[model samples]
Target: MMQQSTIIIILLSLFFLTGCWDEQLLKDVALINSQAIDYDSENDTVKLTIALVSGNSNEKVPTNTTIVSAEGKSIRDGRTELDKKVGSELFASKNQVTMFSRKLAEKDIYAALDGNYRSPLSALTARLAVIEGEAEPILHAETENKPLISDYLRDLLISAEDTGAIPSVNLQNTLTTLYDDGQDIVMPRLKTVEQKAGAKLIGTALFSDRRMTGELNSEESIILLLLANSKKGAHRMTRKVQTDEVDPLYDYVTVDVENMKRKLRVKKNELGNFEVQIDLVLKMNANEYPGDDLYKRHVIKRLNTQLSEELTKEANIVLTKIKEANCDYLAIGRQVNAFYYSDWQNIKWKDVYPTIEMKANVDVEIIYHGIIN
Candidate 1:
């Protein structure tokens, strides 16, 4: 009797099963590959630019992109204007990259991104960047050799993140860090190159809370990421160890970090002040060293000492920049709070962060060399 009733219930439930009610068809709406926000000082309004990806389906490269723009007071308002200009096109589930102009980023980046955070449909996974100039021009950048501006820029940023040249970040984590007192955020910086025919991932933009506090070039950015232990893949760097060498090529050495061990400590010392010490021990494989005397013990030992000093000096420079900007990408504040709550509560972090004594030491060891070496 129970089996018969179960069978009847299963058969009756199938009758009420309905199809997908929220399914959106591809042909009806355009997919946004990239979106850029710029401050229009003349109009005192925000300009929104989106690269709608529409091209040959068979080709791998994003060859064709339809550029669209709208101006309004805010991101959602701008999107509303964009909707009226192009019917049924406020969707951004497929968005890959989001860019903000340096002017806007310096002013109030949080305001520009507020709408996207509130909306559940926003592209949380999209890569974020700060543009050197108007972000829209990068979207309008035309090139014959590359894919669509959106695709090209996205790939460039992803590759940079992989190499630890830029921070791996998105809109999602940015929101969390913006409100956190412990740490600040960093985003990749982008700019047009070669007369607007192409673009380049320049470096990174340092942020305190919501506004961009400072900028770091490519090398400085890489070193910051390394010190923070935020590197994703192989950290390969070429530095001029032999500065006085006659040949430029012979002056430099290229090494790939095989393994890295980093230690960061935040302690309140006898002086009643906080101090941070970062130590990095890196094991590297030499990819290129024109002098090529790795077999000798003294040569390897000397090179090891040279690379360590060079990296430590470079790290100090970058750390000074970070401290000057008051950008706490290392989350030292969090460590202090977690470990020493009394000290954290006594001091206002914003005032103390810049004044804190911080030091970085990097030691590099070349474990192996390429065949030529």
Candidate 2:
């Protein structure tokens, strides 16, 4: 009798745990894949746009996505307006991307993101970006091959980050940096092109205290990514070989950055000025040198030195911009806080960063010269 009762209990437990107990049916739910927020300064209102997935998941690809927008006093109020427009209740658990227009981002990013922060269903890791203009058009933009706009944008962002063209930023990273006293956030920049025919990734937008302070072009962004010692796949660049331009056979050489290591240090000099030094050790492959003699050690050494100098120059430019913006995206303040907490308490980082002495040192090695010499 005890064995029979044990078997019945086991069967009941299995039955209760078998399927989803409170799962909402797909037909009753609106799964959001992307969201965009814009602010209207004239009327003091917020605009919220969401891209919602539709159709059966049993099919290979989703059939379509519908974009809906609404305006209200705040994001929550705007969301309520959106709910009234769409028949199904909206959910952002599957959101893959979130974007804010420059106007909205500049005004107050934290205010715009308050709903997401408070909501449990919000996607904390959704890739975040800043759009050049109104963000609604980007979600509505049609594609020739790829049907889903969110998937296309997410893939493009991932590809750009992997190629070291941009720094990866998501909702979680943004919030973390915004809360941290030492670091700032950098987000990918997007722009609509040709009457919303498509979208283009312009560069990267740097934020200081949740406000858009500066931007880095694609080239500058790569240098910043390298300075940050971001791990990525091989990044390629073409540089003039210092060869005579008149009859140059190999005027330009292509270098692939296989790996890079960066070290940053903060210290006080004898003169009582704070100093920061950044050193980058880079392993590179000469993919296209054109010259047959590039395999020679001396030629390789010269190329390495030249590349190092060029990279250092670019790194300096990045540092200059970082200083100009007064945005410590490099986390130099963290070093100060850890080592010199008393000094940090007295000195204002924003004021000192502009005057601080910072230098970039790059060490490059040409690990390979391709298969054919």
Candidate 3:
């Protein structure tokens, strides 16, 4: 009888602790999905805008979002104002992306990212990008079938990154590169489309230290990715080639990069001349060939040779831009630190980078033509 009475007492105690004592309800929490920060340079103020999914759990898919904005002298102050603007308590743990206006990115990227680091529940893995104009406008942009702006932006970035059109940069990656001495950071650029009533990924913004130095167009961005030997899923490129007896300067052919191998080395020649050599080998598929006679051995050989030359030329152009920006995204500085410690210690890398002898040797093999060929 004593044991039974004790068991009943324990069961009754468990029932009282079943529900959360300090739990916050979903309906009373505003989950931030994305945020955009714009800076007023003259006043040294920040305009922070956030997009939050409407806490409407009744529907199968939440189709609406809320936009709230606040301005203050600092990011933390802005957050306080943001709390007053929203109906429910603000939560940032669900943030999917973060954006900065071009002016803000150029002014101080590290400052813009400070809040991300300080917040314990901040979205550390959120995608980061720079907007061409004001950052707030992106929150209100139309997102067709994709109801939420955050979902649209996330998918857009993931798609471009997978195809090697832009570099994959997130909060953690950006912070890592920004802090690393030997490397720089690159972020995708976003701009509003006036006619389409939406936004699109434009190019990529290159950063030196805490400021954006330059931008690379879509084609150049792809070339940069290629030079970095980024792992991509079915990378594709369209190049112009001279057709047989064609009067036009070139005809376009689209090729799918089936397989790629690259080797980079920094070494001193017999004459003690330092050089950086890049050896690239690509197995490609002629996905779309406008030229005639695809099966001809001479034509295949000519195409292969032209492709290799064009890639080499493109690599040179990219290197020139990289040198001009003086942003070391190629990990060349890291290589020097590892292999040429004496030289690295003796000479400043920024001064020697532009003068360094860099060469690209490209070899392309056309593994398959289209099924029609």
Best by lDDT: 1
What value does the lDDT take at residue 145 in candidate 1? 59
Please write out the lDDT profile of model 3 over residues 1-373, one tens digit for every residue.
Answer: 9999999999999877767666878778889999999998889899999998874568877888888999999888898899988878888889998999999998889998888787887888799999998898988888687889989888888899888788888887788788876788889999978854678888888877788888888788887887789868666889888755654434877888888899999887887656888888989989887665778989889999999999899888887787777778887888888887987888877677767778887899998898875
Q: Considering only N, C-alpha and C atoms within 3 Å, which residue pairs clash in candidate 1?
A: none
Q: Which residues of candidate 1, in runs, are more than 4 Å off?
A: 1-11, 55-63, 243-246
Off by over 4 Å in 2: 7-23, 56-60, 243-250
lDDT (Cα atoms) of all candidates against the true structure = 0.87, 0.85, 0.85
- How do the predictions measure up, each by TM-score? 0.93, 0.91, 0.90
lDDT of 1 at 245: 50
lDDT minimum window of 10 residues, candidate 3: 243-252
Candidate 2 clash pair list: none
* CA RMSD of all predictions: 2.5, 2.6, 3.0
> In candidate 1, how many Å is residue 53 off?
1.7
Query: Which 10-residue span in candidate 1 carries the lowest summed lDDT?
Result: 240-249
Write model 1 residue lDDT over 1-373, tens digit each, in one string. Answer: 9999999999999999998987778768877789999998878899999988776778765568889999998888899889887766567887889999999999999999898888777889899999998899888787775557777888888988787678788888888999999999988998898677788878889988788999899888878888998648776788877764577778888988888999998887899888899999999998888877988888889889999999999999988998898899999889988998987888889899999899999999999997764
